[model samples]
Target: MRPLEGHHAIVTGGGSGIGAAIARTLAAQGARLTLVGRRAAPIEALAHALHGTAVTADVTDRAQVDAALAHARAANGPVTILINNAGAAESTPFARIDAAGWRRMMAINLDAVFHCTQAALPDLRAASAGRIVTVASTAALKGYAYTAAYAAAKHGVLGLTRSLALELAGTSVTVNAVCPGFTDTAIVAEAAANIARISGRTPDAARAELARFNPQGRLITPEEVAASVLWLCLPDSGSITGQAIAIAGGEVM
Candidate 1:
């Protein structure tokens, strides 16, 4: 059965990778979608194909997020499921990261989750199957070199997820995080490129180095992460909350 049929769902970063995969998965489950992204082309294309609405907004900006969701609601009704999937990564030594860069990381990876979750909480609380799933990174659970800022923000994401989950434990809303490791996505591709550039390694070798982080010796798939998010949104997963489920192929226990 299409468990989410008619449910209003908002998926940020719905343009590609994990976000797009989640959007498609939720759409297939019969959820009405609001595809949120900074770019217009990709999300619009995906939304068109999925028969969903597409809204553009800088998710890191609270006012923009609010305005964008206002439009999304007009198109798809109140949001019941919020997927905080919009995020970026930067690889830099801790000493090299400036204040601006650190703040940018926090804004995109941490504060943006705050804005979107806050904007959708009321509707989620009202829905019979409210779900808030944030696409965090395995970095949240563990540490990595040249990624202090990114790791810090992601770790903050888990803290937010758990704290919110506790505060809303008695409600219908469930807050959780999916932490992926070296996912086969544009973000990973960028990381590979950065590694290649810095270490003068071949792109293939750099990617392989990342894959080696996982005990499974392969990169995680976007669909794999999406599947976990879909499961959490299901009615049967109601009892699960305040949890950070790792999709890192044992990269993080």
Candidate 2:
């Protein structure tokens, strides 16, 4: 039998990148999926391809989150697995960081996690087993230059994951964070382009600069992060709560 057969999962930011990859993986394992994102088109296309439901809602907004969950429940039943994969990152020096930028980072990276988790908690508790995985970043574990706001928000995500893991101890629910480093996604591509503009280097060179952080000397793939998330959601992984699993190719260690 498939590991996730008959489970219902909600994946935030499921339109593309890591969230889309995770959604695909979970669906292949037989889970019914709800793809949630701020934009409907991308997720709707993905959901159509995957035979899942697409929900349009901004995770940062509590009302939208609640409405999305209600829609998801109506479409796919109660969520048994929650992947808090909706996030954004901005690169700005500490000195230049504005209040709006800082709050935006926190809203998408940290607040979205809070709102989604709370909205799904009841369904998770009622499930035979529940798994909550947040796609945090290596920034959550260590500092990154010109990303103070992003780093701080990711750090908050890790803290929230740890706290909830402990708070839900002894229950069937497991909460954890997957921290990836310099993933090769559109976000990184944009960052590389920004670096190219600032440093007058080719985009490839700018990408290489970021990849140097990983011992493997390559950016992590979205599928690799999805694999880690899949593992955490397995029935055998009930004891793995509260941990921050790094998929950074040894960057953190």
Candidate 3:
């Protein structure tokens, strides 16, 4: 039998990027999925393609997250695997980082993870053996030059993951974080655009410059991050709790 046969999983931000990749990979591995995202179109499209359930909700809102979790549980059974992949990122000089921007990043990146994982506990406990994975960033382990707020929020995610892993230590549950560096996702496009506007380089040049941080001289792919996530959910990964596995192509060290 497939490793994840009959398992139920919930993937937030499953509409696109790393989240989409994770949802697809898990489904292929025999995990039934419930995909959650703010937008309906992409999530629905992905659900149709992957034969998963889709729920559109703004993860930053607690009530919305609760509703989404309920919908997911109804469709896919108790969430034996929770992928807290919904997040936002922004980069700005430390001196220019405004409170509003800071809070927005925190709400989507840190607060959303808190709310989603808390809301999923009942279902996770029902499963008895569950996996909770958060998509953090290399910035969480290290620091980023112009991404102070984003880095802080990701760091908060890792802290939360470690704490939850300890809290549920005796139980048949695992909590971990996946920290990716310069991945080829829409976030990279946004960053490239922002950098191009600020530094007067073409967006293509900005992307290349960012990719230089990865020792491989290339950007990490969403599929690669998804694969690492799948590995953490395997039966053999029961002992790998409270870990922050970096998918940064050796950039964080």
Q: RMSD to native for every prediction?
A: 0.8, 0.7, 1.0
Question: Candidate 3's residue-wise lDDT over 85-150, tens digit each?
Answer: 998888788999999999999999999999999998877766756999999999889987988999
Model 2: colliding residue pairs: none
Stretches of candidate 2 exceeding 4 Å from the true structure:
none
- Judged by lDDT relative to the true structure, which candidate is superior, 1 or 3? 1
Q: Per model, how many backbone clashes are there?
A: 0, 0, 0
On residues 28-112, what C-alpha lDDT tens digit does candidate 2 reach at each position?
9999999999999999999999999999999999999999999999998989999999999899989999899999999999999
- Candidate 3 runs further than 4 Å off: none
**How much lDDT does each candidate structure score?**
0.94, 0.95, 0.92
lDDT of candidate 3 at residue 210, scale 0 to 100 = 91
C-alpha positional error of residue 24 in candidate 3 after TM-score superposition, expressed in Å: 0.6
Q: Which model scores highest in lDDT?
A: 2
